[model samples]
Target: MKVYGVVAAFWLSLASATILQNGQVRPNDYPSTAISAISSYNSSWHTYSPGSPELSYKGRWDHKYISWWSAPGLKFGFQADQVAISFGKYTSDGVLVAYRLGGQDWMLTNVTANSTHLFVTPSTTGYNLTTPTNVTQTLELRVTNWAYGVQIQCVHISGGAAKLVKIPDYTRTMELIGDSLSAGQYATLEGISSYSWGLLYGLGNVEFSITAYPGICLHEGRCYSNLHGQTAQWLKIPDTSGRALDIYGSDLADIPNWDFAAHPAADITVINIGTNDNNTANNVTATGYYNSYIQLINEIHTRWPQSQIIVISLWSGFSQVGNTWQQGAGFLDEIQNVVKYFNNGSLNGRGECSSCFVYYFNTTGILEHSDIGPLYHPTDVGHVKLASHLMQYIKLTFGWILEQTGPEVQHDTLYWNDEADY
Candidate 1:
């Protein structure tokens, strides 16, 4: 967890114009006459940066209207941590290109749009220019046919050089404990995207480490006789050499003894285990899974006395585990009750009070398939949906502004290398 302070320094450019008010997009700022100019506030011409565009199961083209303005040079002085473009292709070859600042015609850049029906964040390059230059910035859709049009949900801008007071690094350090889903497998065709990993990767700042096994069920009785290998594999501490140990029952004895002194204590801990426990046909008991979950929660809370614990119920498509219950009704209902119970319990000294919160978000197995990659994990689209949901919850509970969910846009080109991990 390295933290650094950043400052946004501005340089004078050659172009000049009356400086606009200090804020993000203001509705009327866009040109109403340009083709079919779509602004954020369709009702009121005030808000500029849109919250989020509605994602599609299939394909739909949407675009936002942008205007050309002059401030003197080719740069509009703003810094963001990450940027995302909510757009879709009309035909086969519709690519969103970065229009060079302060230019009339659209100049093409090498940013490739993702095939998934979601907004994709382009790889961050380095600083836009050695020094800031006053220029007009906007996005352009480059399609094979001039008449063909695509739809853009919105443009997300965040994490740039901090202006005014020096801004510190804000990527939350999170600890995830669960099964294959939490491990971030099978989200995309190539398994390149998982909901967890996508959240970590998509956000401008956030570091994550996963501790999960592939086939282990959350219920204690479901543990097979050969649980030793699976348990050892699940807790194989990254970058650590350890001995193989058998894990019987739901008691994660090995994790408690592991040294966490050097590792940055997790700020957020997510527990997503229960898909396998609900493998019964038609009959399932909420109380049964709840009791085991209570024990697991108690154990996790006992160990990480200060970390926040969040429990997630499995997404739709998973079947109920039992002979009498077939659908997800009984299982999810019970799980929600358990979460509500545990959430209240945190305030009663079970976990970190005032700071801990538990929530259950509905996820879909199909959303994972939308990734361009071959794995079944959540695609970038799926991650965005999850992020939107999580961000709302976190904002309401923690009373913190979701920096990425605001009205603002700044053009940036960050040079990123695929070989390195940030």
Candidate 2:
């Protein structure tokens, strides 16, 4: 892959078409459009150039939900009767295109890949863009696959040219690190419009990243031999075997590591692990788990010194295969003890990181009552519940105000009265 410095001309070449601004067609000489890695965007995982503008490498671990480009002044152009998007090297079975039109809520549309250069006319699901023409809108796009990648070359409008504007940088950034639950494995099983908790939590102005894999565990040599040693593995790009591939080859062999310096550090990092660690087949002891947990936290602190790390408690639902409810409780207890140990300065050596915290959200009510998907994974409703609980926790812990309201909770009368198993 080619590496380019942060030069002005690099960003300018992306805008190949003219845009309308302030009721006038701006000259075609402006920069193509601002294309930068924001939230979950990572440049190392894919390849890009002028010829194959948005091509991505094909491999097992290359799957990711990368944010391609953000156009800020979309509201400036004439009301588009139709919008056309072009993609290159499209390999995914299907890709989800999410965008916010005008001031309305974010909408999801799925585009099926047909060939190398695929053109798609997405359905305007939520807000009608045909009636409104003179409003400013911000557009963001993300790929849905966690193992395959896609490239978005450009977007066009039917009525008038789209005015490319600067992408807005949020005041705070948050990162969620965990396994399938945090990755929204089955949130969309019910429907394509379903959203993950990470996306819902980042609804408004908060930039966020979801670094997770479905079957990943906290320790190595489990479920999949390709798993990494700790949760920190997701911070880097993975190879075919799910191992962290060296970011720079040959010349940088001595410094073979992901250049985290290129990515923005998190202000609040929430970790939800241990579900896979509790596997009976893994035979991991309580002491071993605690040591691994603390090591992961230390690594996170080293990466983002200013980050407030929040270690989430294991969601109280299912234990690993062959484990009973009592064993699951014990696992949760061990995790709680580990959190206390770190908070009390017993593990950190240095005094406790006052900003660090632990939060518990009981999943028993949601999962045991069938308010979830197959394998007891949280469905759309369950994700919303998790997000709502986390939002309240964030408000109380950090005193941060909600920038936007999340999706409305869908309560099922049948399961509303079910007793929580945990």
Candidate 3:
């Protein structure tokens, strides 16, 4: 496979068109190895561009240092299926992590304040994710953080261009199942920024999937309701019978299926739900939610017995019923204990300490805006801070090798054209 260039203009023009069949994973030439080499930072060229005319933030905005490198002749069409992404710990505030393909949002996932703080120690915490449909596309990792200090490595990608059209390569996959956060709203436009992007960019070597709904909760089918002074949608019944956008119900239509094609040969699964659980009056029982979480882990294990499971908390946003400092902290502690009890197996030496395997990320920062979005969701900066925290932990837990990517290729600056902008 012949690799290509890494110039700013190259990436900008490259990003414009449908980047299909340009990213592929080969097993023969590619060895199943973890990258642990670190690359020195270049202040001038290792960070994301300052701002975008189309996007704005309410909190302080700053980007972290990032580096990457692509393989030769490894052109993936916009239709290559089964793309896997994993990465090292990202240590920065409010960072947006993801593995991007062309412009479409695949393997949509994020590391919130809670996930970041819980696992942000000096270790790497990661997930194996896959996309729902089969599309040939380029695999690119993007980060959104204020400052930077971490290394990322792509471990694996399965199959060729036609792999997606037939049956998506079944390498282990993790479903980012949750509400708007997982669905990736205001977080960043589809291809611009996302938690899934970080997963993809960091773990450029794995195949994963995404099963997120814009306004979904874990209570079967529901939305988040107001908890504390915040207003979160609740899980309710949608009025399909009526026309206007008034009626609401559990709408899992956007949820992906369990077909073999969609399911990868996953060995690591992650579930980050529950914020919306406390949204409505019919709040899901913490114990019951814990029980259901265990069952979900079991079901996934049954499919991929050797897989490692991780249950993450929602990024900080609205407070729940008893969200006072001490009460909230205690509630999370209990949830963490329950997760450990379920997935604590024999020492498997997956690198991370088994005891700390099942993790928890709490929203540490207070939101600056109470009404950023319609239902009072966090603004772009809020998501960035959360991603930064999670990336830090992932790097520490997994000593990932850094990619020797050239200067931070600011696509906007490279492709800026006064004539194009009216």
What are the clash counts of all predictions, listed in order?
57, 9, 103
Point out the worst 10-residue segment of candidate 1 by lDDT. 1-10
Q: Could you give the candidate ranking by TM-score, starting with the highest?
A: 2, 3, 1
Candidate 2: where is the Cα deviation over 4 Å?
1-83, 103-108, 112-135, 156-161, 189-203, 238-258, 316-327, 345-368, 372-374, 405-422
Which sequence of candidate numbers ranks them by lDDT, best first? Answer: 2, 1, 3
TM-score: model 3 vs. ground truth: 0.44
Q: Per-residue error at 175 for model 1, in Å?
A: 1.9
Report the backbone clash tally of model 2: 9
Better of 1 and 3 by TM-score: 3
> Model 2: clashing residue pairs?
12-32, 14-32, 15-32, 63-146, 63-147, 63-148, 75-135, 75-136, 75-137
Provide the lDDT at 259 for model 3: 40
Model 1 TM-score?
0.42
How many angstroms is residue 329 displaced in model 3 relative to the true structure, after the best TM-score fit?
6.4
State, as a TM-score between 0 and 1, how close model 2 is to the true structure: 0.63
lDDT of 3 at 277: 51
